[model samples]
Target: MIPVADAFRSGGAQPGQDALALTGFAAEGARAVFTVAGAEEGASGLTVHYRTQGEETATVTLLANGTEVERLALPGTAGAWDTLETGVPLRAGLNTVTLRTASGDNGAFELSGITVADAAPAPTRGAALPYTAYEAEAGTTDGTVIGPDRTYLTVPSEASGRQAVVLEETGSHVEFELTEPANALTLRHSIPDSADGTGIDATLSLYVNGEHHRDLELTSRHAWVYGEYPYTNNPAEGSPHRFFDESRVLLDEELPAGTVLRLQKDAEDTADSYTVDLLEAETAPGPGTMPDGFVDATERGVTPDDGSDDTAALNEALAQTSSEGLGLWLPPGDYHISDHVNLTGATLRGAGEWHTVLRGSDGLGGFFGRGGTSVVQDLTLDGGATVRDDAGDHAAFEGDFGSGSTLQNIWIEHSKVGLWIQSPTDGLLATGLRIRDTYADGVNLHRGTANTEVTHSSIRNTGDDGLAMWSESEAVSDSAFRFNTVQVPLLANAVGIYGGHANGVEDNVLADTVTSSAGIAISTRFSPVPFSGTTSVRRNTLLRTGGYEPNWDSAFGALWIYADTSDITAPVVVNDLEIVDSTYSGILVSWQRTVTELSVSDVEITGTGRFGIEINAAGSGTFSGVRVSGAAEGGLDLTGGFTVERGEGNSGW
Candidate 1:
C-alpha cells in the first residue's frame, strides 16, 4: 500500500523515532552520506517521520500536507528532520496520506496528531479510517536494457510481461518496442554493484513507442558481480544498493494512449532470460510532477541529442551531470553535435553504456568538461570523421575538471580518446569508466593531477593506448590503474597507463598483441620523469604484446618503468603477476638512472617466443620469486641488475 521511499518517519515530533524507511545523501567532495529513515502517521492530517545523521544539511517537505499548515521546522536540529502537516484535506475518522522529496534529501518527516472532527471524538468512542488508494504495479516489465539513448527500445520480446525483469547488464544490451502508447509509467530494476567494486558492467533500458526511455548502468560492483571482476575487489562491506532517478525515455511523455512496454537484450549480446513483472502505469498527476522513474546512478538513457546521436548525448550528459541520486539518461538516436559540449552538475539519465549513439559533427570533441561534477554513461561518443585526419582532441569526452569534482560510472567509447582528464584534485573517482572501439587512447590521463584512481574496467580496440594515467607532478599518488582490457586492433601502440607517476597498476588484463608502444609502457621519451610511490604492479593477466603493426617497435608487459634522471625511488613491487600467451618478448626494463626497489615475485611468463625477463636495468635492483618458460633465448637478459639472489629461469638468468 505504501511506497517504498515513503517508509521514513511518520509519527509526531520525536528524537530518534522515525516513520518511513529512507536513504541516500549528497556529499561535497566527501564520501556519500547515507542514513536510516522511518515514518508514522495518525488519523488527522498531521504526520511525522524520523531522519538520520548525515554529512550535510537536508530539507524535507510535506507531500500530503502543506497549505493550511506551513512547514514546521522542528524546535532544534536532531538526528532527524521532521515533516509537519499543512494544506491537508483531513476528513473524519482515520486517514492516510503520502509525502515526497524527489532528490538527494532525507525521506524522514514529522507527523502531527489528527483533529478530523471540529470536536474531538468522545473519550470512549473510536473513529474509523478514510479511503486511501495504495500504489500499484500495472504496465511495466523488468530486465536490463542497452542501446542508443534516444531509441532504447523497439517492440515487445517473445518473452515480454511474464515474471519480474531485473538487472539490465551493461556489456549485455537489449531492445524493446511498444505497440501503442500509454500514460505515466514506472519500471523497477536492480543495479548490482555500487562503489568499491568494478561497477556493475550491466544495464537496464526502456523503449517506449519506438523511442528510448532510459539507459541505466551499474555504478558500483558491490551487489551484482561481487568478486566477479578483479580490479573491483572493493569488498561488499557495509554498502547498500542505490536506486537512482533517471530521465524517462519520454519526459512527461504522453504516449499514444495505450503504450505497449517491452524489454529485451541490447546490442552485441544475447537476451538474458529474466523475470518481468508489471509494476504500474498511470496519467500525469500534475504539473512539475515526475512520472514513474528508475535508473542506475551510473547512467540514464533520457538525454538531449541536439545533433549528436543518442550515445553522444548520453556521453555528454554523463560528463556534465552528477545525477542527484539519479543516473545519466540518454535516449537512442545518432546525436550530431556541432560545437563543443561542456559538462556541469547535471544528471543525464539514459540507456545502457556503449549503446547510446553519439556522433560529433565538427572537428571538436563530442563532450568536454572544463570543470564541475560530470558523468557520462551507456552511450557511444564517436570522434566524428576518421583517424589521423580529424585529430584535434581524440577524446570524445575531454574533461579538465581541474580541481573540480568528477565521480564514477562515466563509460565512454567510439572516439579517438574515449576519455581524457586533467583534473586539479583527486575528486575524479573515475571508476568503471571504460573505452571501446576507437583508433586512439581509450582513456588518457594527461596534464597532471593527483589522487586519481582508475579501477575495475576495460579498454579495447584502438589505434593507440588502451588506458593511460600519466601526470608529471607529485599529485598522482594514492592513484591506481587496475583491471583493464587493453587490445589494439590496428597495431597502434596500445598501452595501459603510460608515463608519468608510477601509479598502482594491478589486477589488469592488458593484451597488446599489436605492435603498440609496449603493452603497458613507462616508455623511452616520458615527460615529468617518474613518480615516487609503491608501483604495486600485482595480480595482472597480460596476453600478447607488440606485433599487430609492422611499423611498431618494442612491447612490454605488466610495466615498463622507463624514465632517465628522474627521481623515481619508489619500488616496482610486481607480485602475483602472470604474463602468459604473448606475441613478442616478455618484458623489457630499460634506461633508469635512479636506483629503487624492483622486486619481481610470483612472476610467471609462459609461451613467450623471445627472452622472458629482458632486464636492461642499469640501476640496482633484485629479481626474486620470478618464473619464466618457453623462451628461445635466455630468460633473464640481466644487463645491470643489483642482485639475482633468488629466481627460477627455464633456460638462464
Candidate 2:
C-alpha cells in the first residue's frame, strides 16, 4: 500500500493531516509525488482514493517520471474517501509517480493516498489474509539461541526451533522480512518483571527497513512479575507469579511488504537479556474493535462510590485489562482512589472529564499511570480536600509511557504534578488538557522522550514551570509544546526547554509568572546530550514574567537562554532557532557557557527590565526587526559580538 505519510517527502502533501490519513493538495498546477515500488514490471494503473470538502468534479493528471500517463476524474464530494481509477504505463523497480491537479472546478481537493498496483481487479473488501511465523519457517539468527519448553534465552537453551531468538548483548539484533504489509503485529517475549523490583531490565528498538520507528521495553510490568502487591488489581490474589508465561506486545500500524522487522537490544546498563518465543501478524481489526479486547472493571466486582474506598475496585478493573489491549470505560461517578494505578495497552476512559471525577484519598501517593497504548481520557483528577504528598513527591499521572499512547481531555488539580512523563517514551500525544494548581511542573517531558507533543491545553497556577521539556538521563528530542496557555507560575519559567534536540515551544500565551524566571526559557541546565538541533520559539505572548520577585535580582525577562554549571565543559551549540514576536525583554541569551546560533526577528519589548535583546553569552547569532520602547537598559546589549541588521525602530545597541 502507498503510505500517505511518505507522500510528504515528495512535497505537496500534508503530513499527519489526520491520525489515519494524509491530505494531498489538489489545486490547479499543484503536484504531489510518491515513490511507488513495484515487484514486477507490468502495465500499471493509478487509483486515487480521496476525500473532498466540496462537490465539484476534479481532474488529476497522473505522470510517471514527469511524463503524463493518465487523467483521472474524481466525483469530488464524498463524506468518506472515494476512489477514482485510471490505467497507466509502467516499467519496473521504483517509479517516480506524480499526481498533478490539472483541473479542479472546486480549486483544491484532499487525498488520503494513491495506489499504483496492477490493473487486475481489486480484491473483494474485508478479505481474510493471515500471515504467521511458525517454527518451521526458515529463520535467521543474530546471536545464540536456546529454546525448548517455551523460550529462547541468549545465554543457553536445551530446546531450539524457529519460535525463539535471544539477545545476550545490548547491540545484538534479529531481522525478519515479510512479503506483504502487516496491519498488526503480536510478539511474545520473556524479560524480567519490574514489579518484581529486579533491577534487571531490557529494551528493544525496532528498525523497519533499516529506519528506526519506535522503542519497545522488553521488560515485564511489576504487577505481572509479582503476585498482587496492593496494586495488581488482579482478583486471583494467592496465585504465585510465574515467569514461564511470555509477555505479549501488540502493535497497530501499517507495514509495507519487504519490511525488515529488527529487534535490537539498546539499553546498555541493564544487564538482563531478552527472550522471544512467538511472533505473528494479521489483518488489523477495524475501528471500535479495539474495545472488544477489554474486560470491564464493574464486571469484575468493582463498585463506584464517593465515600467508600474504590481503590481496590479500580485496581481490579485495571488488572483485567493489563497487557490484554482492552478498553475500560468508567461510568460517571465520584470514585475515590487510595493509591497509584498502572496501566498497559488499556484505555481507561470516563463519561466526561467533568462528569466523572477520581478524588484522591488522604496520603494517596498518585492517581493514575500508563506505559503503553493505554489511554486516559475524559477524566478529572481532584487532589481531594487535603494533599499529604509533598512537592516532587507524587504526580497525578506518571509513567514511562511508550509510543501509540495518548492522554486527552483530562482535568488535573492540586497535585504534585499534573502529568510527569518519564524518558524513553516516543510518539506520546497529550492534548485538550486543563491542569492547574500543581505542586510542580504541570507537564514534564523528561529525558529520552522523542516525538512527543503536548498541545491545545491550559496550564495555570503551577508551582513551577507550567510546561517543560527537560532531559536528564538519556536524551529528549523532536518534541513540541504548542497552542497552550500558561499563567501564574509561582516558581520557575512558564514554559521552558532545558535540553533536547529539535524541541519547540511556540504559539503559547504566558502571563503572570511570579518568580524571577522568564516566561520562556531555553537552557542547557541538565541536558542528557549537547543541546543540538533546531528549536523554534515563535509567536508567543508573555505578559509579566521577570520582575515578580522583589528580592531576587534576575526576576523578569520575557525569554531567557543560557547554560548553567551542570552543563559541564560542552557549550551548547544550538544548530538553529527563531525567536519572534515575544514581549518584555524580547529575548535574553545570557550566561557564560551558553553559545548559540540564533535568529531574533519581529520582536517588540514594551517594559524596561532588561534590553530588548541581550547576548551576554559566548556565542554568535543575528538580530533583525527588534524594537525597544521603554527599556531601562538598551535595545541591544551585545557583550559578545553579534550581527544586527534591519533595525526597524530606534533602539540602544
Candidate 3:
C-alpha cells in the first residue's frame, strides 16, 4: 500500500501524512502524481480509498507513464470514505501513476491512500449449454489424419483439440458414437474454394447405424478470407485462409446415447477434399407458431414458391396490416423479392425459417421498419449477395423499431449484415434467431439503441463481429446481449461493445474467432461517444477464441479491454467468465489513451497459447478470484512499466 502523503500534489492538491485533499478540481487538469519505488514487474491490483460529498458520481482520469489509460467514476460517498479497485500493470523499480479530474465539473474528493496487491483468484464457471464435443481426429476414420499445426497463414486453424481428419477421396468416412441423446448436430468442416475465390458448395452424406440418413449442404462462400486484417475475399489480394465454416441440421428423430453416426464423402460429394474438424450435438427446441387473427399474404395477391418478384405484394400486405391493425402471415414457400418491403407497426409472421423463405437477388431484398411496435417472426431472409458492400444497407433486416419491437424465430443469411438496427430505437426483444454466413455483423444496435435485448440466438460464420453495439453518433445505453451462442466468426470479435453506457454481455457462448480480434471486446475505439455508467460482462464462456492480429503482427486475448479513441472512465465489471483454448492470451488489458475503474472477478482461463493474463497498457483495475492454468508463456505477462503484487490461490503459471 502506498500512502497519499507519498504522492506529489499539484494544482491545489494538499498532501497530508496519510491523505491528500484535492480541491478546485473544477479547474481543468488538476492532478496528483504518485511515484512508487521498488515495485515488482507484472499485473497487479490498484485500490483507491477516498471520500466525496458530491451528490453525483465524481470522475477522475488515470494516467500511467504520462499516457492516459482510464477514466474512473467515483460514486458519491456522502462524506464517508470508500474504496474502489482496478487492475494495473507496473514495471520493476520506480513507476509513475497519476490521477486527475476528468473535466471541469468533476467533483472534489479526498484520497486516503492506494494499495497495490497481487492478482486475485476466481472460481471456475462451466460452459453455458450441456453438450458433448467430438473431435474428428479422435473418431474412427478411414480418412487420413491432418494437423495440429498452425504455421501457415494461408490455412485455417483446426477447430478444436488442434487436429482434424481429411477425406481426400470418395467413400472416405469418419464415424463417432453419440455420448448423449441429441436431435441437432453441428459440423465444423472445410472444403476446396472456387478458382474465382467466390467459394464452392458441396454436400456431406450422413449415416446413422450404417443406414443413409441425409445429406448436409456445406458452403465456403462466407469463409476463406484473404489479404491483411479486416480481410477481403478477392483472392488476388493475398493468400486465402480462414478455411472453415459450420453446417447445422435438426434430425427428424432424437438418437439415443451410443448410436453410431458417420459423415462420408460420397460419390455425389464433388469437393476435392473434405476436412472435418469437430462436431457438436445437442437437443434443440421445438418450432414456433403464428398467432391468431393474422391475415394470409396470399389473400392479398402474394404468390409463393414463384421465381417472380413479390416485393410489391409484400409491401401491400404489410401496409394493410398497419392500417387495419391486422397481422400478416406468409405460408411455407419460397418468395423472391427484388426490392425492400417497408414495414410500419405491423406484425409479420411465417410458417418457419425452413419453410417460409424470402430470397433477395444481388443484395436487393430486405424488410425496413420505420416506427411503432413491429413484430417479425418465424421467417428466413436470404439475401443473395455474393460480396461485401459496407456502404450499402444490404442487411436482411434493417432500420429502426420506433419505441418497441419483437423479432423471434427468424433466420437470416447471405447478406452484408443480418440485423442492423439503427439509432433512436428502443425496447427491442430479439430471440431465437439463427444468423449465419453474413458479410458483416450478425446483429448491431447502432447509435442510441437503448433498452434492447438480443438473447437466445445463434450466430455463426460471420465476416465481422457476430454481435455488436456501436455508439457512433449517439450513446447506445441500457442494452444487452445475453444467452446467445456465436461461433466461427471469420474476423473481429464475436461480441463487441464500442462506447456504450450501462450495456452488458452476459451468459453468452463465443468461440473460434479467426483473426484480427478476440471472443469478446470492450473498447473506446472508432471514435464513439465517451462511455458513462457501468458496463457488465458476466457469466460468458469463450472457447477456441483469440488469434493472430495481422496488422499488429501480434495476438489478441479471448477477452480484451482496449481503451483506445477516448478515455474510458466508466466502471466495468467482468465476472464469472470461463475462457478455454485461447489461441493467444486468455485475458488482455491494453490502453492507447486512457481506461480506468475496471473490476474482474471469478474468471478461469485455461490453455492459452501465450499468457493467461497480459497487461500491455497503463490503467488501474482490480482483478480477484481469477484462476489460470496451462499458459504457454506463463501467467500474468505484464509489460509497459507495469508491476504485480503476488496473492494467494492462483495456480499453474
- TM-score against truth, every candidate: 0.52, 0.55, 0.74
Question: Candidate 2 on 569-642: residue-level lDDT in tens?
Answer: 32322211223223346567767664546666666667656566766666565555565666667666777554
- Say which prediction, candidate 1 or candidate 3, comes out ahead on TM-score: 3
The numbered model that scores best in lDDT is 3
> Tens digits of per-residue lDDT for model 1 on 1-653?
12232121211211222424333212222221111111222233333433435434344433221111223343333654444334444322222223334234343332222222222232111111111111112333343332211110111111112122343453332232333233444333333333444444454455655565655342222112222211123446432211111112223555564454444446632224332323234332222111123243224443354442444444444544444433344454455554566666543433433235555653345666666544443344555433333335446766665432433334454455676677554445454454544545666677565555554454554545666666644335445664454543333344544445557666666653443346556542445546555667777776655342223344443346564546445666777767775555667666655445767677777866567776665665666667677766767667665345565542344
Worst 10 residues of 3 by lDDT: 119-128
How far residue 623's Cα lies from its native spot in candidate 1, in Å, is: 2.5
lDDT of 2 at 402: 60
- Predictions: Cα RMSD each: 18.5, 25.0, 15.7
Candidate 1 at 260: error in angstroms?
A: 29
Superior by TM-score: candidate 1 or candidate 2 = 2
What digit string (tens of lDDT, one per residue) describes model 3 on residues 1-653?
A: 56664454444455543435444444454566554432345666789888887657887888643345678888888888898888666543334566766564373677766776742221122223324779899999999887665444534353544478999888999999999888889788889878788899999999999999999999887567677654677888876766777677878999999999999999999899999988888654444344566788999989998788999999988998779978898888899988788878888888766568899987778988787778787788988876677776478888888654667668887788988887667766676687877878999999898877786678877878999999997999888887788877777899989998899898888887877779999988788887889999999999988878766787889999888898777998898999998989999888666557888788999899999999887767777788999999898888755444344545654
Q: How close is candidate 2 to the true structure, as a TM-score?
A: 0.55
List clash counts for every candidate, in order.
157, 10, 25
| Residue 287 CA displacement from its true place in model 2, Å | 23
Residue 142 of model 3 has an lDDT of 94
User: Least accurate stretch of 10 residues (summed lDDT) in model 1?
Assistant: 150-159
